[model samples]
Target: MGVRFLHAADFHLGSQLAAGRGESTDHDETLESAVYTAVSRLFDLAISERVDFVIVAGDLYDTDSRSVRANAFLEEQFARLAEREIPAYVCYGNHDPVADAPTYVELPETVYEFDHEAPEEFCFPNADAPEARIWGQSYRDRHESRSMYRRFTPADDRIPNVGVLHTGLNPDGRRYVPVGRRDLAGKDDIHYWALGHVHDARVFDDEQPIAYPGVPQGRQITEPGPGGALLVELDAAGSCEMEFVPTSPVVWRSVAVDVGDESISSIPDIERHIERSVDDLAATTDRFDGTSVSVRDPEWEVDGYVCRWTLTGNGPVHETLGADPEAVYELTRRLRRTLAGRRPFVWTEAVRDETGPPIPAIDDLRGTDRVIDEFLALADEFDDAARDRFRDEVGMLWQPVDDHEEGRPDELALTDDRLDELVDRARERVLGELARRRAD
Candidate 1:
């Protein structure tokens, strides 16, 4: 018989979510609860599937300063697992280092939390198949600059070995337990490597089955799309099969709607367009639901969507949306209100106006050097300058406010790719202005 287990990490319990500007505390609380709800679904899945064990790579809690409620939630979930006779192996991540975890809250006997002081291995001997060994270590402190993988060595006995660690794959620095893919692949005895820290679910290798299940639920707009866990089945022959199981109640999505078409002229027309977009998103969810064939699994059903809308393309409506920011805000508010009254709700967290004025073809404006040509050249210069400014100055804004700050998170720094996007928007705006002037 095969050894079945679920792999997940970065629960980040008690972490605050990003709410819309001026949103009430109640709404923010609801968003926060959505994450926990997703976690509960994970435990439920373990019990329902009768998996022999569950592997939580790390970052169960968002921080050492986690709330009592978050601690209780974990205890309750573990107790549920214990009742089902399913064991859970967990390692502490940087966010919830072993040294910092509250001593008052106790984990259930069924849960095997790796020791922070040294690397440890737990072996489960099956009556009918080869024994399985799981090797792991917890974060001793918030910053483990060295590679933790060095401390781990597969057990001597010929058995199915699984390695778990909260690490990054050749990250920017040694801040997070950085381990190379080749280093993991070099381990001859280890059949699977379950990793954590990164929030996007990905598979590094299929044969040996190295994977990151990502965060079960996304807490910010930046972490768009469904977040979930991985279900792994390992046979006696040392082969592994894995499946991704999404568990997020609310999915974050960013969508761009082009308004260059002549039909989209007024705010109401834009509203209708947004309605169609929401319906389209719902239809997509519906299709997934139909194909999933499992109503009990939360991964199969998308309860709702939180979207960030970006309006693009050149038209008269672009001028209106760009000229009046309030109108755009109102449109977002109206869409949110309208969607709230329906099933498969969609909340518009933000609306960005990236629309530009309609312009004549570049071929027509080829000789008109003073307007279109001059603007294009200037746009090119601005793009280079913008990239430099962001690279140098923007990082300072994300630095720690003080040495003692605990809960303060690092600001999301702008990347070169993001800078290129901003430059593109700026170019469009400049062209739109020049075109309007030429028409006038």
Candidate 2:
């Protein structure tokens, strides 16, 4: 009468975590195998929850090459699913190995991969007494441009209709299967759209729920926080209930320690600040709500944290932070030496010096000097530049708009928030310099 299933996507099985950029450590083993670990936990959760089926929308592999280990790993995990009679539905995405006919690693009988050529339909529990009708298609090549959803014609029945796609949505459907949200929402017959391609999970709470479970594991700093699959249940009456479950063993956290607000004056003070933050992170990781994960849950799933720290805000310690050119390097080494050995290990990927020289307010700076006022006025002119617009323009100019840019992506030096911080710091320095000159 009711169907319970797990909706997941972007397994990226052979994917490797970004490594060798920073100091080497014991956790390199953890980083080396994090993706595989997350996926193993995914199946473990599926068996524990006893879900009827699992939907893996796309990007099941990282590249076109056949990896013995990645393949063997899937075969093993899927076999575990088979032992429990839990079927996994799979499709391929841009980064998947489907660019050519795959010499797939032998998986279990329970793994039901959809046709890569066209949209096809299958009934859950069988066509004779179907509870759910599922339709999906896979990418035949690395570059898939077909609007596969257009071919979906679910049989006329009272059964719940579910649709699956690996799409770029409407933005640039020209390359990655050009189906839009409006179009997906317009399909009255389909009760749920299980989508992929986008690594960030998103859900629409319309009459018909549309969702992307995102990547089951985050591979880098950009793909941080709780990464997992969706637990979904649809009742006979067509009401759907969903919950996100975190499966990542390692979580990438962007830690913004405001040295100014906390009066963090020394390496010890900074360490204490970070320690408190880690305690908060660990205590609450298991309690993450789907609201944070709906676009934005745990085994309390963290095993370790890989952090990128940005020392923000202006303060007396800002000068202290900048006093030594190696200040950030030294502080980061301290954190690594202290925290990485603790339970649920904390590792520092890097430390950034964004802290600024503490200065008086613009209001105080104004009416004091004519040149300072003119400079402040000029800075204010650029303040009107929208953060969103700047990011988009910068991305278009620098980062290519394509699925799966080759190789590990370099860390983006400027983010929207980073841009704001830099602007604020610049203003602080200008004001501080002007004030010093005036005092002279």
Candidate 3:
């Protein structure tokens, strides 16, 4: 009664999209192996949906380049389709390993690799009924500027025609191989265009019903998002429908938290900030109808929030935070501990201090009453420079003066006169250090 098929492309097996530049090559290679897991998930999708056939548009590998392992994984995917009795039709995109040759890889017998020379019709003849026809083509090179569809004619008027390709549809004209809308539209043999190349999923030109399933998962910051494939279903009467099903085990998200003066006053505030960020991400993802947010706090207690925390920071915060400094460090550790088992939360110690201003100078004052006058004159002159150096120094200078005058009996030993002397000398130390560095 209907033709139901699963449409997907850009598997890029062993491509290592998740590979990182700073990571050891071994780690990148391990990430590459993760694709096999994603592929298995797709097989589950196919079996669960009970689709009659699966169409793989193109770019089956990250590149035409392959190692023994990549090739082996490729064979496994096709074999799985065959095991389920679902015929799979594969077309070679620019990155296909066999793009230039008719030679077959060790694929399962049920898998049909399309040709470049002409559109071949595959008739799936039901035991009790007539055959359903599907046509497909392959890209002969990495950049086939011309349309590969010129050779294909529609299926006989009696059969439903489905067309598949791996060429760039609306690709960036400058660098990518470009295929235009005009070229694909009004084609007689194409009922549905299962396309590939661009990694963002979308359906284009309702008249043609062409689609791009995007990459299954992101490889870098530029590609951050949920990555996966598409499932297409058609009725016995040949009416078609499709839905996107994500297969990525990991997700990437970018979160921005604004730090105002009030927010950084205490540990509880910082904890609340982080919690709110995770909550906001959850909300945004829900609104997008996407999977949960997976924080990647690489250099701080943020990236790889679950797997690893690459400690990164400047000055004190960078120095492997300690439990002695209030409860803030403990709070950070607690957040990491609490979010460990959560799928959407990943705690990385990539926290870097964006704190502004520079370190201030401490006082070098000692034994002399006349030092008060000297300190007063210098303090007036250095006040502006002290602000420019580090606000902490200026804040420290005023603390003793304020404390003693307030008659706080438990305060550290110091008079207003002594405090002024200390303040002036501290300013000189900071300025002198700056000058010394410049001199060097």
lDDT leader:
2
What lDDT tens digits, residue by residue, belong to model 2 across residues 22-97? 7678788888888998898888889999998888898877876757788788899889989888888787777773
Which is the winner by TM-score between candidate 1 and candidate 2?
2
Which stretches of candidate 1 lie above 4 Å from their native place? 21-30, 125-130, 236-238, 282-300, 361-440
Per-residue lDDT for 245-346 in model 3, tens only? 766655555443443333254445555656656654331122123322122222111113212222211123322234245444465466555554454444
Scored by Cα lDDT, where does model 3 land? Answer: 0.55
For residues 298-372, write the lDDT of model 1, one tens digit per residue. Answer: 435776778888898887897777677699988987877777555666777788887877876666766676768
Q: After superposition, how far is residue 425 of candidate 3 from its true place, in Å?
A: 41
- C-alpha lDDT of residue 329 in model 3: 45
Instruction: Give candidate 2 regions above 4 Å deviation.
Output: 19-24, 99-101, 235-237, 261-269, 283-297, 316-325, 361-367, 370-440
Task: Name the regions of candidate 3 deviating beyond 4 angstroms.
Answer: 17-32, 97-105, 125-131, 171-177, 235-238, 265-272, 280-440
Could you arrange the candidates by TM-score from highest to lowest?
2, 1, 3
